[model samples]
Target: MDIKNLSLNPNYNILVTGGAGFIGSNLCEAILKNGNSVRCLDNYATGKPENIAPLLENPSFEFIEGDIRNAEDCLKACKGMDYVLHQAALGSVPRSINDPFTSNEVNVSGFLNMLIAARDAGVKRFVYAASSSTYGDSKNMPKVEDIIGKPLSPYAITKYVNELYADVFAKTYGMETIGLRYFNVFGRKQDPNGAYAAVIPKFVMHLMKHESPTINGDGSFSRDFTYIDNVIEMNVRSITGKNPDAVNTVYNVAYGERTSLNELVELLKEYLGEYDSKISNVEIVYGPERKGDVPHSLASIDKAKSLLGYSPSYDIKRGLKQAVDWYWKNLQ
Candidate 1:
């Protein structure tokens, strides 16, 4: 991240909620590298400890072991911060389908708690993680933020509710808020061990072990697979952007292209094969389509580009190679 190019000040203080997770930890790492003061708040329920372990020794980094469900913890984390990056949420559509109560508690209620805390702390801007699932059941190929359809799952509902709350806070309280609706973000440190782990990492892990990965549908389901660096850039741009119109609105953060499940698996095998030639022969299995999943997800990133100056540096192939290399070196 070039601080000069982004027009960011090196001395500013930033707070990252869920800073021990894949996306949050990366944000903390980048901010610290940019010479900014960073405070992280996470309970480690879904977040990994090793993700933030190396950052613990940084002089400019602080971590608070706390959950967003606790209002006091949220207040404590938001104090003395110039900006708040809210990435704390119970993710996964299947998990939410099995248990809606826990999802609502952490995603909706906890999100509200963070908002109130940041408002009280007088944070200059609040940038949060939204989701493309909000466009659930919409027939649109390239998703635009304003043309959202009814949510398909409990988790999607919660994320949509977040956008509502953010708009309310911005309009009613005069707060500066920007919501980024990320589309299938993937990269290093993304956990592949869990049952609800995302497809990319899970498939990578399976391929590395020479095991077949199951595709929920007929391998036609596609996603706008975004890279982590692109996501980090969007967050940083959201916090530093000065456009008045840009605030109080949401933008889709994506690479503007879609990759089908078949294509994705082939790409994974092709890349991982470079490291272990046997990986190229791994077979992909097909299964029933999962509930509450969309057939295709592609985003129109023109809004983010025009408003936040977000130019994604890595495409799917480039980013996947980077991710495959990391998994090979670390997980293998």
Candidate 2:
């Protein structure tokens, strides 16, 4: 679906926390182009200033360098903002496992700070990034919003807590809140060089350099990899959607199909190979599955479709091809 179809009022003030990160920065760019004033709040804990560097030139864009862990910072960012898209948090399960305290501080406590700030600021709606990890150990094939399993890691716990806090605040204060539970999101501007980089970008980089990409646990694990534009559409709907049923709920933001690790590698190689045929000749390696790894994950985006009118335009192959092209042009 064309993003311009969402059609939020041009003059409304929107605040996107973590607006210097991959998904958040994309949202900022889309919102600004739609003629809205955008305020970006980021401490750069995991976000990059470079992601939003090009965005700084827009007079309608405002950048606030601050941490969400500070309640005062949260309050200042929310003040006068009509809508709040809270995306600031330390992502990655391994990173959370390595440091749970900091993860809890930012994802949990910091989320609370944003909630309070948005509530007090009288923001019309609070749309935040939730996670598929919240499904945890459920073993369900197509994860639905109502059913969930116990959290498997610190990151999962924090994301789940965000849902609970958002629900409570909505009930207690009569605030409008929506959560988008993202599933394996990837696209341009996703950092490919990190100890906890996402598999798609990391593997793309590995193959681009003619290096072997390792698969964890025999390459059978799977995920519902959604594209950035799809995620951007959902965030826009959460703010502009007028349905009362869509408010005060969480919807899975995904393409609704699972791709195995083996298939994922093959697809990336095929797409990247178009740029450098030698990448197709790259070797594959195997390793023991890391801790906190789920065997497979898929989401039921029915709720998003029925309520939020979400229509994801890209599947794995299409999104991967676009991503590979971006990495070749920008990163290589």
**Candidate 2 lDDT score at position 201:** 92
TM-score of each model, paired residue for residue? 0.99, 0.99
lDDT for predicted candidate 1 compared with the true structure = 0.94
Clashes of each: 0, 0
Q: Judge candidate 2 against the unseen true structure and give its global Cα lDDT, from 0 to 1.
A: 0.94
Residues 1-332, model 1: lDDT tens digits: 45456767889999999999999999999999899999999999999999999999999999999999999999999999999999999999999999999999999999999999999999999999999999999998799888989899999999999999999999899999999999999999999988899999999999999999999989999999999999999998998898888898999999999999999999999999999999999999999999999999999999999988999998999999999999989997
lDDT of 1 at 170: 94
- What is the number of residue pairs that collide in model 2? 0
Instruction: Quantify how close model 2 is to the true structure by its C-alpha RMSD in Å.
Output: 0.9
Candidate 1 — which residues are off by over 4 angstroms?
1-4
How far does residue 13 in candidate 1 sit from its true spot (Å)? 0.7
Minimal lDDT window, size 10, model 2? 1-10
Compose the digit string of candidate 2's lDDT tens values, residues 67-185: 99999999999999999999999999999999999999999999999999999999999999999999999987799999999999999999999999999999999999999999999
CA lDDT of each candidate?
Answer: 0.94, 0.94
